[model samples]
Target: MKSSVIKIALILLGSYLIGCQQRPHADKLQNATTKKIIGYIAGWKGVDTSAVQAEKLTHVNYAFANVIDGMVTEGEGRFDQDKVNIQKLHSLKSRNPDLKILISIGGWTWSKGFSDAVLTDDSRKKFTDSAIAYLIRHDLDGLDFDWEYPGMQGDGNVFRAEDKENFVLMLKSVRQALDSLEKVTGKHYLNTIASAGFKSYLEVNDLGQAQQYLDFINIMTYDFVGPGTDTTAHHTNLFNPNLNGRSAAQAVFDHVEAGVPIEKLVMGMAFYGKSWKSVRPGNNGLYQPAVWNSTHPYRNIQGMVGQDGYVRYWDEDSKAPFLWNQSDSIFLSYEDPESIAAKAEFIKTHNLGGAMFWEYHEDSDDGELLNALFQSLRK
Candidate 1:
């Protein structure tokens, strides 16, 4: 009878252990299906690796690698530092094994070489070869092309009518190259792009064709209002009742209409705010005329809020937040925890892929905005 009791006890203990193991594995699988939170780390500013909360992020895009003379290379004079930064970013995997690190190539100033680089079959091949080589060298998980505008003169980039078609071709070439690499390594390499947020950019390129080659299309939904626009408005508002104005909702709708799958679209949030000075106080500075002021990181803006005569205001129609200094005639547009929470709800309701922010360092040292995003999205 004692021997029989021992056998039963062993079986019960074994079952308990197995159940414990399966629970965590099941939880992990569930987390995998949750929305992605992609953060763009500005390597140009030099990454403070220790500050990055890798657990909160699904992916980190290092901005940027540059295109020079039909080859993918490090930014001008940034090779040594970028290597170190990338290495540190790789080390972050110890904290979150599922984290992905990617190299973002081409930005507003570095995009000038794209037109010439992809102008011909041979040129496209060369660019593709260089991109793959760079990916291998850096031990990166993916590549993100931030080519600015494909067929337009972005920061005086060399553009042609052919860019509309060539843009798709370039993505196709990169996708094929990644597939080839996958065959040998048996590891999937992601291909993504930092797409422009406005309608004009979509009018020029065939994103429908482009999406087939991409894993995710991160729409730059911020910066609707910036320099050269002497107007005060929300730069990263989630909605705009005025159909003519720009908003995150409008951008997402346009992308769907442009043929990009809703499942693969990731909306962007700003960690920084746009400031305008010398503003007319009409309507509390919303949609009023003012001289464009310098941009401020959310951390700095946090200190200015409710201080220095800055009073925070919420726009119900747009589901955004702003700061107004009626005494000083200054206005600031930005994203806060409340606004980010609203965006998270929007993401869930729309069944969108996830949320992506322009940069990592702009948030508070304690990661207030990122925390809000992670909690809201994950919950």
Candidate 2:
């Protein structure tokens, strides 16, 4: 009897460990063997309907992924539930039966809506319940909460100290609802979120409270600085690509130490670059205006080629790469195949949870960069 009890106990313990295997393992997930987690973000309402053309790849991140903030935030910022978005998502799932569609909520604009949603229980419920339905109807493989952050607010909203702990509670509620739905649907739903780039976001908000509950976290590793700044720097580099303190790789390390398990940390890759006017000594840094390109004077840096303007080509030293248009002498921010591939290799060599890119439309229609990512992962 004693022997049998010990055996059962050991098996139970093993299962629990597997459930909690998100940490330390990230450093060893890849070796001369095993597959790494490589995902992409398929966003941009302007993206082609067949965006998931790279479905053959192991995982698709579904970029600049937005959360259903409802019709209220729809005007200017309101998201329309067009049949096209739903059809495309389903098509991606059907094409690659094994493909994972993670609905990323919140982005450069979506975050503003979150500030108001979290303040009241009724409102939070309205958002949460609607979200649960969104996940179900959409048949998402998981949910990625890109809340920009709680306890702190940007875009006209004020941050409340209580939001620190409330973020965890919010995650807990989401997790429970997801798991419950899983029981009936007989499917395993994933739960991930995008973490703030700054350390203070975690410290003051105590993300440690929610870390354990999340299946993974994508650290927005880019945007250290851009056109709006008085200095230029690499937006996404494996290490000190531009010889700067802020690089995509460093952000990954920062989150790991913040109690966010390494396995649960997914590095955010920017497929786009930041641009500024003229390469003068005072011009550098990522500008917010890039996401809203229409209102900005800087044209699509990647789209213009053979043109006498913009800096094009990868900066091998920075490992990130960028382009500078000549005509307007405007600086554009973006990441190329070579740069993202290098970072993906870093992710593999370091044994990280693969990598994630910013959005879809930023990449060339040729899908050259996404092709590079698939090739790197295959090797």
Candidate 3:
């Protein structure tokens, strides 16, 4: 009887330990309290700081720090603008002292060099050294790599099958460099990446292995449906009710299942919308072939909501909003406060890291979407 009882007690203890391993840490809960509201600041565009509510954001990522010859540097003729924007961003510290400013290296257009820059150990170290120096020189908090992809073809970028493994090595090298610098400066510098949202990129890189050397992964959940598609679909839907497998929720699940902790996944939101002309005139003009129209900033979409041949429509299936102009055969897929609120709720429900958006200046002076996120998450 004594032997049987001891075995049962051991089993119970083992079960408890397993459960503890799955539970979230106390720091995760604290971090989620102010859940990061990261916004990308476009350095090339003219910014209006008065329109931004600095207090609502936790971090501001300055977009597109060019990578040249395996080093991070200013784009050609962009030194003046880059310096001014960095200063302007730093000035906002007076309003929100806790705001972290990071320099985002490589974007869709500038990611071509990443393949060669991170190919070998020596090259990766060179890139890491330059990135750290650039951060210190700009008085930035950290660095973000928007590499588009590692082993996939992206916007004319070179790719090799070996990149699948090299990408992991590159991140490990970078994390080490960041750690060394942290020791010297006595400050914690965040290392993050702008990851591809779909499974294509997921299949190439080992996210579980890479997550060890990173802070958080910002999934670019937008552009799932773009001008290149034959049918108009929800570009940034929270849920994919139709089973099309192209929604923010699906991407989150995919990453988590692939071994990335949910606490390190930040759902991406788009501040702009994609419009298409010549859409079929039924079913609210959704999932129909249409001619691609210009990508409209949220500010532009706001004005056209109830005017200019645009009538807003809510999609219950995708849990998103799209504009369908029946008279003009036009359709626009975008996000608003209601949609953003749903995403915030989703984040809390799933215990996600936080939410991030593409660019900041697209929002109105009132910061409608950002306000929705701030209120929803805080509440």
Candidate 4:
């Protein structure tokens, strides 16, 4: 009888321990050893989606659905063109059933309208209604708001101090609308935002409130150093050892610390490179005074590698690569297979959501950068 009582007690204790065990958090979810791989397909790029290697991606966001006077415009002026492109994106599901296409609205060029759209309850309703109708009409799986910013006019958008709270109110309204439609259709719709990586941007908006409504926030980690800057540095470095400026890791921590769940943040990688000309030769033309030159798509850069006096060098501290053409006094900073792999490792190490790039057209036909991300994340 004593032995049987001891066995029963042990069983009860084991049951209690099992019941107390915690489930995995969203960020730490064990999703087949790889997180979601999202890629942006810029609408104006005129990319032929049929040529896209759809199976490599889990989600493709259609770029730049214009917002006009508080109304969501499916396309800026080329409505038919957008329809055709969206159709092509949806058709990719035949090849990869898991692929989801989302409509991204209010990019840098078109974000001006967002200020007025979310200003009032009535305006928010109009915008929310337009968004849902647009998604349903296009048969899209989700919506991504890429308003360059809220409560800021730097992107040629109107601003108000109230934008901070208004932004959250707008997102909540949209989420509620989407949920209502979902209940009727018995389908899920994802709602996300393309957020700025800078800490200043995070402070202006209520990300904690916004996060509750968003499926995830896509952090634009690239472009930290662009043509407007005076000095040269890695615009998308994973870690800033020297602390010259913003790093991807810093941006991730800022957002997560600001109340966004780690799993709800998707880091953005640039598929193109930012370049500078007339760079001083000191420090191998890095962090030197230089004039910002035009950006080079990875496809174009791939062709320039090891040619035209161009030589690529890797920075061990930043975990990024740069190209210097000593003959032309040109310096280029961008992501490559190695830097991208490092970023993938950062994502895995931090247990954050997977990687995303600017657009599919910027990559080589061989899909070099995309392949690197997919392979690295899989491991």
Candidate with best lDDT: 1
Clashing pairs in 3: none
When sorted by lDDT, best at the front, the candidate numbers are: 1, 4, 3, 2
lDDT of 2 by residue, 1-379 (tens): 9999999999999998986676434544434133334455454454355655646344555544343453122224324543345456667656667767766666656666665565566766676676687677666788777776677665455567877766777677778877888899889888778776766676777656688778877787877665356544555666673333676677777777777767677677766665555444223322222321211211254456446644465556568665555455455556666776787677776666666666555666676666776666545
Clashing pairs in 4: none
- Full-model lDDT for every candidate: 0.92, 0.62, 0.87, 0.87
TM-score for candidate 1: 0.91
Please write out the lDDT profile of model 4 over residues 71-165, one tens digit for every residue. 88866577988888899898899999988899999888888888889999999999999999889889999999998889778676788899999
Stretches of candidate 1 off by over 4 Å are 1-33
C-alpha RMSD between model 2 and the true structure? 8.0
Better of 1 and 2 by lDDT: 1
lDDT of 3: 0.87
Q: Weakest 10 consecutive residues, lDDT, candidate 4?
A: 23-32
Estimate TM-scores for all models. 0.91, 0.75, 0.91, 0.91
Clash number for every model? 0, 36, 0, 0
Q: Cα miss at 170, model 1 (Å)?
A: 0.5
Measured with C-alpha atoms, the lDDT of residue 62 in candidate 2 is 52
> Model 1: which residue pairs collide?
none
Error of 1 at 18 (Å): 38
**lDDT at position 5, candidate 4:** 100
